[model samples]
Target: MSFAFTSRRLTTLALATAALGLASAAQADNKNLPVASDGTMPSLVVTSTVPGGAFAGHNKRGVALDAEAEFPASRLTAAEQAVFAATFKPKMAPYASAAEALDPESVINSDRRFRVYPQESGYPYRAVGLLTFNQGSGSFSCTAWLISNNTVATAGHCVHSGGSTGVWSTNVVFYPARNGGLSPYGSCTATRLHSVTGWTSSANPEYDYGAARLNCTVGNTTGWLGRAWTTASQVGVPIGIFGYPGDKLSGTQWGGAGAVAVSEARKTRYPIDTAGGQSGAPVVQADGTGPGTCQGDCGIAIHAYAASGGNNSGTRITQAVNNNLQTWINQP
Candidate 1:
């Protein structure tokens, strides 16, 4: 909503991971999905034979056009073909063709890894980005995060823009701060969206942990946060939660303070001092262990966010529980 305390009476929804069509969930260890094509459409898996033959449609981005559209497929020379190939190659893995592999260095390091905790002066891990949404209004906002390989964690509310479909609706975006917070990760379709069974059913904001799956890569980069498991839920632990809060670049960047917090009462609690844009963030414990459950992230309960001491408390939602969410990604 426009304000945090107003408490918008909106119903939260859940999406299974498979709906995203991602390679693997739960660290099933599948590789990253293929990179999207030049066109805005999701990348299609075309065989080498198809590129020069059957491929005949131009995707929305117009970059992944049919080979027939490349002009003369036969009269083209090797050098000419090489130049064309570099322009329209597709695949998420490191390039297989030398033509497309021109900028290997930049492509490889494109995804910047970041740590959430051990808050020193310059922990480059914390990332903050605008969470563009359309929740009944046209205004824009932001969210922050700690990376886990193109994967970021923040609150559900930040991404839930408005209705359920179309542009500027629910399923907001996260743009990791690179290039001085200027460039943005291309908007990915919400392949899968979800939240804990408990939170959506009830009206608890602390347990309001919801996550959305992106079919497109932001920044064409990578970032990942290890999922916290139920096996390790500790209270009174220091954790970090990063996101692009309402503030600006000059102010507290990287979603502000990532001090430690207690993890009592796993669910039905969240005492972090962040506003709306900090939902669904991955909370990391200071010990560097699993249970990376922290506030500003959502979906499954792992550990609540209480004060450093034991005075306060909140819910603990982690990918560990949400990890299984892949099972329900596309039930239909």
Candidate 2:
């Protein structure tokens, strides 16, 4: 299928803001500029075909997590290793706040995360999984979740290296509710990748969110998470992050919940614990309150970075983001 933004491009932000009454006149005006000029950009969509097949062969059912062996060490090339290292730069500190600080006992050895087992047993959890892909000269992994029958939302960095010199990723695959090597709902490969020019061309964290259109309709069986955006402050709102973390057993889903510590125009920060592989995980409302347009189990941000300054952060789902996601979700 050809990849391109839908008819709703230029006026999407305007209409969304007006309908939701979420942003002020100044905020809406600033968001309407072209992305390279430090404003929102149109979504960039790319299409690719899985060379061999779309379905990953590993569909072992009723497999025990403990019985599976650990994944082998990554065989990244020197150049790829350097690129991976750059992602860890603590350029920004966590959002400073008294509530953002956690008690030592509140976190177990500085990690408050817990594993989610029988991943396919329920909503939200079953929709999230490990996202493994090949970029440059190495293979890497991140987290992703379904938003539509064939669309999986993820971090922009997971799909492209970012910036003027970056390249789009290859051999992308999504393993929904994967427990160790057991793919309860099977696996699917990406046929299309979508992000914004702000991220693909400028590597801006404000736009560091992306989505993939799968070759299979696995989300129908797994169910998908609802998404929402608001101009209202998100501080103190209870939220959760669920995804496959590399710090734990391979393919294991670990998650945690905490109050939103900081809310920026394009970012949201929290005291939640997350590791490298958890990037692109959904940051959803934990209080079961579905704000404007949220159907339930609604995601408000795409978890993207580890604790900087103080709290972990992600790309907040703003008006422009919601517009692009709505378009992507309805793509044929």
Candidate 3:
């Protein structure tokens, strides 16, 4: 409910500035979508997907979206077209609900989590689910990252979907899979799920992120990533990311070896795809050193990169660190 626009509802909006009805490669200026260069930033007209369908919906449990075809556009501007191409694809991942395919009563680390062997030193995290309304039959899931055996961070939108109707709690769970192969499940009930005054009032995706204080350490597991950087996030940094993609399997590493990008939207183009299930993962960056993360990544540390990126293949604060849901989940 963070957005009025869901996969379920998408109505057309009339254009005011048809100045450039459709920007193309020929219009290099339009391609960049200049940010700080201009005194005023250009507002991007997004071609939103219809709500409640399978356009890009990832699967989890039993809730899934079926395959659907897209119509070619003749009314898109340059940026809209680019976003369309960037997001436009065939069969990314399957969508499902949490209980749908899970082996009920399965052990956490054994069946659920795909443990990640960190080559470098940094934090690891993942998302969880909380049963929702409708007689236990129709439930909504929220995303969270395991900070330790007990804490995590997530989007405020994940918790309170505006007002009493969408806000959810109870029976919360966490899954850590820096890799998509295996996933370790952990239980963490929601002790607190609040957002900034600015975030609640404004459905701003950037400000919509939130954090959760878990009741205990994530099953008392050791080697889980610790927390760092407590607020007012800095830009121009390269960030590592992780998440459980509902479309495909979990434990993703889709970008090529060291194909790094910035933490712009908290999402990047990578092969390790997740539709809706990969919500609430962490986007971390290195503190000391170890293994690294790349594009097509989610939920890792957040940082702007160093130049050249040979020894440090990090991303820029420009492309990668924009519109991110910056929150310190389970950061103690």
The lDDT leader among the candidates is 2
- Stretches off by above 4 angstroms in model 2 are 1-109, 118-120, 290-295
Model 2 local distance difference test score: 0.64
lDDT of 2 by residue, 107-202 (tens): 223788988974545666878878888777767788898877678888887887777677777888787777765665667888778776677777
**What is the model-wide C-alpha lDDT for candidate 3?**
0.30
**What are the RMSD figures for all models against the true structure?**
18.7, 10.6, 20.3
Per-residue alpha-carbon lDDT of candidate 1 for residues 127-178, written as tens digits (9 for 90 to 100): 3333444444343444434332233344433333212231222534444442
lDDT of 1 at 198: 30
TM-score for each model = 0.45, 0.70, 0.39
- Cα lDDT, model 1, residue 91: 11
Mind giving the per-residue lDDT tens digits that candidate 3 earns over 220-297? 332233332212222434444444333333224211122333223322221122234334444443443223212122
Best by TM-score: 2
Cα error of candidate 3 at position 115, Å:
9.6
